[model samples]
Target: MAIDLAPISLPATADAEQFKDFGREILGVNPGGMSEEQMKEVHDLLHKYSVLLFRDVDVTPEQQYNLTKSFDPSSENHGHGNDFSKTPGRKLFELNAIPGVPQVKLIGNGTVYNHEGLSEAVLKHPSHTTFHKTHVSAEDTAKGITRFQRWHMDAALYDLNPPRVTTLYAKVVPQGPHQTVRYDDGTGDELEVPLAATAFVSGKTMFDILSSENKSVAVRGRVKYSPHPYAWMATAHALSTGLGIVSEGLEMPDDELPLWDEDKIKVYPMTWKNPVTGELHFQVHPCGVRELFVDPLPAVASREGALYPDGAHLTNLMYKMQRPAIAPSLVYPLDWRENDLILFHNRGLLHSVVGELKKDQIRAFHQCNLAASDEPAGPTPEDVRKYA
Candidate 1:
């Protein structure tokens, strides 16, 4: 297919040179403020890095929304709002907050019941008291609480026409502790796990799996919790035994829980070709992709031979050889700061938030997937080299 390569040129006043270094240092460019040049540079940097970070800009929530308009005119409100109880000035998103609705807090210490509901008992007590000391052991509570810490790429779950951009503005960053981590797939620094591996774990080819037509079969007639269609697949993969289990649902078994073997499966490669820009990026997320397009044998063997059929195994092994062709090292790590705004090309890069921070420290950020529908094709050495 002829990919879309519409040129989103930098605005006339923007200094392309000043922002080019942003691609080298951090995901965001220093747009300083509303200067025409700064705004244009910010726009260019958004396309280049896929994620941008601006520090101490002090723009109001309205100005922040206006700033996002430079890149995406149709940007909408999404992601968790700031914790009003803890910090009054902090409003993560500009949408109107309801009166009786409990204030939302972004700290990692809170309890997350299924479907975005918070436990009343947990809410009544302080996070440190309810979670750290009593209700459940802190260790167990920590694991359960952090399950939602890294949600999927905002757009990955959707079947709608792709959104243009997602913006996250942080108003309250705690002192000395919380930091957000991000990864970019477009920069040629993304880790590549093959397509075949994704198919094996999913029990279907990645292409057939993500198609909107298959949503009914994949979800099994139940109403999906999130609007993002891929959310179910990502959640299933994350909960699978090979991938690594977080907590158990009523029907899942203990042995079937997912396990994280970083050494065995360090990355997942999703084929994303941008329709507007014709650029291809190999993307990875925390969702469980053990081997590029391959299935790993379970610790226990089944009488049926392997958990997956032979075709799955062969496809996975074959994709392994192709890994060298894509240059797996194209993935890069994103460091976090107190007040950083980072935007990344989700289709171009496989990104993840490395679990490196301590419990007490907080890392808060919101993300939305820029909408576009360019089907994933196999990766090419040239595509990898262009970003590298």
Candidate 2:
């Protein structure tokens, strides 16, 4: 069954001033001198809409910092800039062009390789280098210019306590269609297999494997197995299922892997619960999840199957069962304009930059992350201590 998300309602005491403070704190954008009643109204609207767009409000770097401080004191800069250089202790993400390719510059660097001057040295080096690479305009046609490409979450590799909120503020808008698209995870139409699917899978398999009673015992036999009893069981499971023993590994056949054709693989419901609000959001990002789990028994029985029949069978079954219920429920078209600043909750939303803007046109923006607040009062210290 699809889970329904009720729209957030505002209380009678909602005011605009309160909202200004809230926005200032969370977004670092201040709407000067809003009354208390006005703040409440804005607060209600923010909770209800989950996004706020401010147009024609030209703000300096310091002012932006002050505004974001209203929500999170630790607001970090997200784009390439020397604008706030004077403000020490402020986190900044610099952007630059990829060398040799004079047209395109590096956006946010991820786990992929960072290259310089079209050489193998750049290809082999890690993507995130300490210093700025170079800046190139789209008109540098001497070298073929390509679009900047990236697909990832803000920061998933880090083990931080509270995930930082991401904010992107547009600084320059070239005469082209370079816009960002966002998907709401809380919407029923965005999810597949429902929240119940995760509950079922976790309860049935993951829980069973972690139980003390289910732990396999060592078999002292002809092959001289290691004293670690679970080693054989774990190894057999990985080889048979092509999954993790202690780490994630891939063994997919080239033909079976997803193709980048227009007909892409169907997305599944990736369930994530907000640590602060305790609300469940359906994630569909293709960052951490490589493929779905499938039933291997039926495919294994077949004598002639594709390369790695067990793996293929498992993946196909999982994908079929977990096809997205609502494909474009949260998608909205982007209308790129000057002095247009848009803010949305990354934790509860899935967004994409879809508009096809040419290489010559520049689309500049700034992004920042909001820090998490303390937990609301409910459970006793002892209850919390148990989890701790």
For model 1, residues 305-383, the per-residue Cα lDDT tens digits are: 3223221322122222112222222222333344555445444433222232344433333223333333334334443
TM-score of each: 0.42, 0.40
lDDT of 2 by residue, 1-388 (tens): 2112222122232333222212212233344443455445444444334455565556443444444444445533332122323322122223443343221223322222323332321111111111112222335312322111112233222112122234345555546222221122233322111100100011111111222211110000001111211211222212111111112332233344323232222222233334444433333222233344321223224334322333331222222112231133212323445555555544444443332233344445444443333211222323222211
Candidate 2 Cα deviation (angstroms), residue 151: 6.2
What's the residue-level lDDT of 65 in candidate 1?
46
What lDDT does candidate 1 reach at residue 148?
13
For each of the candidates, the C-alpha root-mean-square deviation to the true structure, in angstroms, is: 14.9, 17.6
